[model samples]
Target: MKKYNLYCIVLFLFIGAQAKAQYLQDYTGRPYYLKTNDGVQGNPLLTETWYTATVDFANGKTANAILNYNLRGDELLFKNPKDSAVLAFVEPVKSFSIKGIRLEESDQADITFASGFPAVDDQTNKTFYQVVGDGKIKLLRYYKKKVLESTEFSSQIVSRTLVTSNSYYLFANNQMVKIKPSQKTVLAAMNDKADKMQEYLKANKVDFKSDVALAKLFGYYNSL
Candidate 1:
């Protein structure tokens, strides 16, 4: 019996080590970014600061590293201390969290502003989204990137501008629903308690035009 128990413990340890080995095997080093000399003004990254991030890969392995995300290219870059190499994380990362940043969305006349969101799913497509809130209902912000070209007046120099469009989503009952940043749309998304929420908004004088206000409304709805 003593020998049998010792064998079982060894098997368990081997399995645990294999799991970790498989997780680390998924990561491969790639070029950080293609060199670019364009003098365009806009950048997809919200800030230039590198943040400590915890990345969960699709293979059920997680690693903690200092990371930065390029919004325009939809790329995740990591600096590995072992080799001191700035390499792009080529594995399919299921989700990652960076410190001191929260994904937020705002709408202008014809444009939407999104920041601090990294794509968690659909890794092959290079689509990026961040989870702003999660509960019975999950709030996701999707980011779409576009390049705009302009010519200078004097030198006729062509420049490329990176623009991003952000769309908000509400996930309930395993269905993803798109939402506009407005009172009507938000209430519609919360159809379960639309009437009551509408009343709450009125009583509280909520400004649906504001993204922060709209997110707060969703947060409250999820709580209830």
Candidate 2:
């Protein structure tokens, strides 16, 4: 009986490992290329023509993106922006930055990943991926370790945009709940602060030292 119980335990462990085996950091998949102009935006490009897709692995998630070339000879560029030392892969990749991969009943799979993710010094938590419908993924952006922006898609279709809190949420209700700036305004502020943060980091020679410095700058920027 003990031997049988041990066998069952091994089987369970094997099954658990297989279930997690779907995740891979770098991916390779069949390419589906579509034509596009030089600098067209994402949605318009999608409307214009179908783009190739490859698996991605980053931010502890698995996701897919439009591939620029065929899978066999194309290269993958992994840029974290925050960590230059993270190493970028320039190989013929079918997928880069893949985290979680799941298949639907129809055989279509959803891949999830995150990029340009900014977080605090400890890196305890940050925005991550959540699988949506078949072949759909979304970003679960977090602020103060709380989910803030949810960028979701369904079967490659835009589902919805949900903002969990206004800028007032940042102030802990101690300050007035002034009307939060528009999306453009907030983005501009963030961009400006990011630039300043970069400058500050380089000036202080502390770019990769810790993320808390950048986070403080972002907080100040949001207050403006």
Candidate 3:
């Protein structure tokens, strides 16, 4: 309930900013100016509601604000503290943490994201990846969002919608490898400790389908 209230407050701020038109931006930052009724069909953000977050900039500065991740543009945006204006970082963030439950089973744990990994498969060091499991061996989830166009039959109007497909990876020993949330792929990535991984798998009933489960598996593997 408290989280929902926070969302409402943040929404009100942004909504008020939109009314000014003078405050909302497009082109200066990666975000396209957000419109409550842009004729666009879907949300561009990971969450339409803003979150209370602490953003760590590349310059080593930090700030607290109501923010959201623009999945379509792959940008982190925050609302101005003063005018409630929507803003984006001149520099991409090194990392950030939002206060809320990202995964249902996380028990209201704060979710964090970080960048700086080597580029692979069209992703750069600046591309933020959700910090699922960390330590020597880390698990990350890259949410790839794309814009899709659709038109209803007998309607000349076309609609653009934002959709995301997520991919997972394991980073260790200065290397990052793409992975699927399956025991086979996970074991293949961590082949060095297959036997130990098998032992852990047997001891804990891990449903690879669950992000939390995969994270727990990687956490244990990293502990080894």
Candidate 4:
């Protein structure tokens, strides 16, 4: 009898705790986003919390983030559930920062393309960026044939880097990842020009290494 009473007490406590605990909920205050293992076309379903977050896109599209998490302005991550038809929430990220691409010279052409970090399932904690579409810049994780997370780049930005092929991408991660050799060339040319200014410095050597003018020259060079 005592054992039964103890069991009852424990069960009651469990129920009470569950009632008080906060499960992940959608904007409607319902747990509609907790669909486990429900995915379409082999894409994983979104499931669980700590897997998505609210993100603000440059285009004014806001993903409440049922499965998507914005890693940055250029990168996004999504976590899919194990094996159900119902997917979890969606996540959107901005991961276009230039941290994953490498630059090379193509003598015949004006630009070159290189594969960048794969946009993996952010929910699964896999590779940095997993490729979903044709463009390296495309990192949209889909579910039920829907775009859960997408990377957006405006036309002006694309035009700046799309001179060559898509193997080249634009990133804004602030990692100092150089994506444009032409930009680098322009910077190098400016540096060379600054060095040549040494002749003027001989008579008016304003410490080109530390002077504001010299620094500005180098800064201008780097901007290219």
In candidate 2 the C-alpha lDDT for residue 85 amounts to 27
In terms of TM-score, which candidate is strongest? Answer: 3
Candidate 1's displacement at residue 128, Å, is: 2.4
The lDDT-based order of candidates, best leading, equals 3, 1, 2, 4
Model 1 misplacement above 4 A? 1-28, 38-46, 102-126, 172-177, 209-212
**lDDT minimum window of 10 residues, candidate 1:** 107-116
> What lDDT score goes with residue 197 in model 2?
43
What would the TM-score be for candidate 3 when compared with the true structure? 0.75
RMSD of 3: 11.1
lDDT of 3 by residue, 1-224 (tens): 99999999999999888755532322124333765475566677777678888877776666666788877677778776566677776655799898764642332266788999999898888888888888888888888667679888999988887667778888988888997768788888778889999999889999877766777888888888
Write candidate 4's Cα lDDT for 1-224 as tens digits.
99999999999999887654422222212123332344312222211233334433333444343333222212233333333233322332332222222222111111111123434333232213322222212212222223243335753322111111122222223221323223243234334455554434455534322223333333333343
Question: Scored by CA lDDT, what does every candidate get?
Answer: 0.65, 0.32, 0.76, 0.31
lDDT of 4: 0.31
Highest lDDT among the candidates is held by which one? 3
Tens digits of per-residue lDDT for model 2 on 1-224? 99999999999999888655643334333233332343322321101222334444443444444432111212233323233222224323323322223221111133332223333332222222222111111112222212133335545543332122212112112221222323333334345456664564456542221233333334444454
Q: Please report the TM-score between candidate 1 and the true structure.
A: 0.66
